[model samples]
Target chain A: MSGHGLVLRNICKKFGSTNVIRNLSLNVIPGEFLTLLGPSGCGKSTLLRIIAGLELQDEGSIAIGGREVDGLRPKLRDVAMVFQSYALYPHMSVAKNLAIPLLMRRLCAWQRIPVFGALLPGTASRKSEIIEEVARVAKSIGISHLLDRKPRQLSGGQRQRVAVGRAMVRHPAVFLMDEPLSNLDAKLRVQMRAEIKELHQRLGVTFIYVTHDQVEAMTLSDRVAVMLDGELVQVAPPQEIYANPHDRRVAEFVGSPKINMIDVNVCGGRLAEIGGQVLPSELTIGQGTLTVGIRPEAFHLASSGEPNSISAAVRLVEHMGSDLFLHLDLTGVPDPIIARLPAASGHIAPGNRLHLRIRTEQLLLFSENGQRLKQQASVTPLREYAR
Target chain B: MKHCRLSFRTLGRHGFLAITTAFVIVPFIWMVSLSLKPPEEIFQASFSLLPQSWHATQNYIRAMTASPLPRFMLNGVFICAVIVVFQILICAPIAYALAKLRFPGRHVFFNLVLVSLLIPSQVLALPLFILAYQLGLLNTYAALVFPFVVSPLGIFLFRQFFNTISDDIVHAARLDGMSEFTIVWRIMLPMAVPALIAFSIFSVVGHWNDLFWPLIAVRSQELMPPPLGLMAFKNEDTGIDYGPLMAGSTIVVAPLVLVFLLAQRWFIEGLTSGGIK
Candidate 1:
């Protein structure tokens, strides 16, 4: 299917006095999967709701399939959502649950009446058509055998699939998902994550997914929109967002084992921690204290005789099987800085002091205000990864 | 640990419940027993729970044959069914609006229902009676059915049960392209089967045994419900034949007892639990 695109312009929403979505505007390309990633209560779900017309925006307009749908109802907007709780009709069997949307769309008022409805002209034909369609979608979702069972009889994973199948039957212009897999167990979550990715590829539908889990956003989307405090902080491809975050909040929120923030000052063209020299600056800078963000993987064990290696004490060592994370304390830095090294790289235990080098090329410098400062050097040359 | 030795607290609870149950049930048992006893035994000085001899066939035949009792029962069934159906049709949507829909004055409307609940239907009897006379509905089945069609207690009960259903299910239904009424009939009502049963039992029993309202609004003998007909039967002939009266009482009470027994599980669950999950 060739998916339709969505354009949200200046969407603003407020719950009572507090702003929930602030002047948010985004353009989603046709057939592209975009994820809205944020912390809980950051209004990503509210934004998705606005796009689906489940909730109206206080100001601004939304377009789906190139048509303005600001005042339209959710069903008319040609969009379907898989809610976090599944929201399956408790009274309906799986088949009836799948057949409901078709029933509402295809049957007239009198045509849906109990006994007389069966006697209505074209009702039987339409009903049989609906059953066929429901069967097809159920087969596609691998829930064909479960059609006779009630929602309560199904496992969590099965319910999740049925929820997806409900939306899939519609073939709407856009698919909206609000943390649909968050309710599953960890193993099921990982397994379902791949299924969702494959589903996205197979349908090739424009998808707007809202999630608080960064890993889901990173793995499932063609582009990820990082939201903070009701505003979009940054929107870029996952790799680009991870490597080059435009805002400090985005940098801090995106990575696991978090990117460490170190306070440093410029001394004789070299960057130094509060009480000791750290790394030599490759780019020219004004003389003032700044924050430098360094990813854990950017640090490496220094040779005994290497220049500019900072000697630090290993406070804790976390063995992650393939890679080992060493929590180290520099002479001046109060908090421990973590370094992820190859697990095969010799035995390093807690309390063992090791000299470590910072790959100057991969070093991220920030002004006092928490904005990333680009360096003059062009580097895939993360001067650290070479070691 | 699994032995049947009862604690003091458990013994007290069972003791209190048993006494109340006997107090409530003894009259019905006595009625059934009296219906089986000959008229002379019913007036005997000696008290007995069961009759000395069976006059059940004669008493039941007399009850059925006397005073158009079958006609009275049919009227009761018709009035109760109409009242319950219309009450549900009107109350479910009102309850749905009160419970789920977001609109201006929802709180005010729900508060009004609660306020109406605080006032007994007897308080409205005067106005309803006058209105029935003005509409020429007095002595007609409409007089009995109309006054109860929009029951506030039903609205309140249904709204409470609807409140327990997740808002997400409603949202999902709306997105599935169902109209509000469709959601009420197909989604909300089916999910609320227990509550409906509980409400229907309350409605059917209340109207089935009702005598006071029917006495005021409907005066014709043929239009009278079972309870009212039984009263007319008492004043008709034989002055006060104890046997047939008890037989009619048993007949009138039988259907409700059977209904309650059949739906006892759901009736209890509906009263205690709010929603399916």
Candidate 2:
């Protein structure tokens, strides 16, 4: 089957008086997995639903495979969705569930007779073809043994596989998944993540995944669309999102042990007063008040001749297997600064006074209005700190 | 002394349960006993529990022949079946719409249905009678079954049950490329089966026992229901010939009791699920 790309143009959806999606636009490449990532009520799920044609937008246009599908019914759209709850038909066996889309496609209306269909003319071959196709898909998903069981009889992970198997049987042009792995346990979620990634590679079909989990988006998506308050803020590959965020919100949202932001003054051609302590960024931003964004890993244990070491008292020490997270209380800083160091460095403890250095190149500078601060290409590189 | 006290406590507990059971069973037992008694001793205080003479077959024959009981029962069955099916078809869609669909005037329409529930059936009887007369449907099965089929009660129950189901299921079906009607038919309807069966029992039993609508709507003696037929039978078989009327009455009550026993589990679950509130 040929792959299809989807496009949403100036789409705005409103529910009653509330505007859920505000003039959002995005383009999906053929045979790519794109994820919409945001928190609850952030319109990520609503945006996905709008794309599926399950919901109508108040104003905008949608195109699937380069054709406008404004008034087309959901059945005519040729998109398969894997739901968070799975939504398997409770009355039907797993095989029957997989056969439904094929049946709707291949069988004539009159041949859908509950009792006479098998005996009817020209129906036997079609029925067997559909059944064989369903079996093939079930086997591919490793759920061939569960073909006869009802959904309720299956475990959560098995049910998820069946859901994927059902979607696979049709081989629709686009697959829309709304948090399909959220219901699984932690281990199952991780296992399913890899399976789904491999499934995308094997099928090479377009997938539009919606989730509130950042890690899922980072791991699973070829491109991630970051949404906030129903608006598309940024869309980029995973590494670019973490290393070069477009906005201050993106930098803070995309990392675990979130990025530390401190208010600063970009005064008189120099970086001054980083939370009332002088900082060394040599090339200054525009002369205005700004905020400095620093990832926890960007800070290191200070040594002699480090350009921007700030002194602080350690408030708490947490030893994870690979690293130690230090919560530090500096004299001028309003909030505690966090530092992540190698676990082998066993030198830090709670209530100890220490000097920690901020890696200059890794520093993220933001404008006062939460916009990222850009610099010229000639900035100094800290080669030893690179992971 | 301790043994005596324990015995008394156990006796009190069993006595309370036995008394409550008797109270629940008494009306049913009395109906059966009354159906068996001879006409002359029907109201007598010293009447024997068993009949002085057996007229069981004879009473059944008279009940059939002396009145239009057979025709009335046939009418009851036809009317009840039609109403039950119509109630499900009509109420299920309305309930599905109110429960799932987002549209203008939904809250207003739901409130109107609730208001209709508050107005007692007796208050609507005159207006309904006039409407039936105006439509020239008087004395027909349509007059009895049409208006009663769109039960506010069934809609309320189905709506409540549908609300318990997550909307994500509908989205899943939609993305599977199923039409809205197909989604309702294939997904929501199956999930709402327990509610539907419960509502069916209520509708069937209600229409089976109702006499007022049939009495007011049907003028032909042949179109009467079981309850109305029993009333007419009681008047014609007066003066110690109570056997036929009692036999007919027993027949009328038996089906409901049997149906309840057969569906006892579902019936209780339905009632507690939908009606306890």
- Which digits, one per residue and each the tens of the lDDT, describe model 1 over residues A149-227? 9999999999999999999997888999999999999999999999999999999999999999999999999999999
Q: Looking at model 2 chain A, which ten-residue stretch has the lowest summed lDDT?
A: A376-385
Q: What's candidate 1's DockQ score?
A: 0.73
**Docking quality tier of model 1:** medium
List pairs with backbone clashes in candidate 2: none
Cα deviation of B50 in candidate 2 (Å)? Answer: 6.2
Chain A only: give the TM-score of model 2: 0.93
Global lDDT of model 1: 0.88
Tens-digit per-residue lDDT, A8-53, candidate 2: 9999988889989999999999898999988889998888778778
Highest TM-score against the true fold, candidate: 1
Which regions of candidate 2 fall more than 4 Å away from where they truly are? Answer: A116-119, A273-278, A282-288, A303-308, A376-387, B1-25, B46-71, B130-136, B238-240, B271-276
**TM-score of structure candidate 2:** 0.90
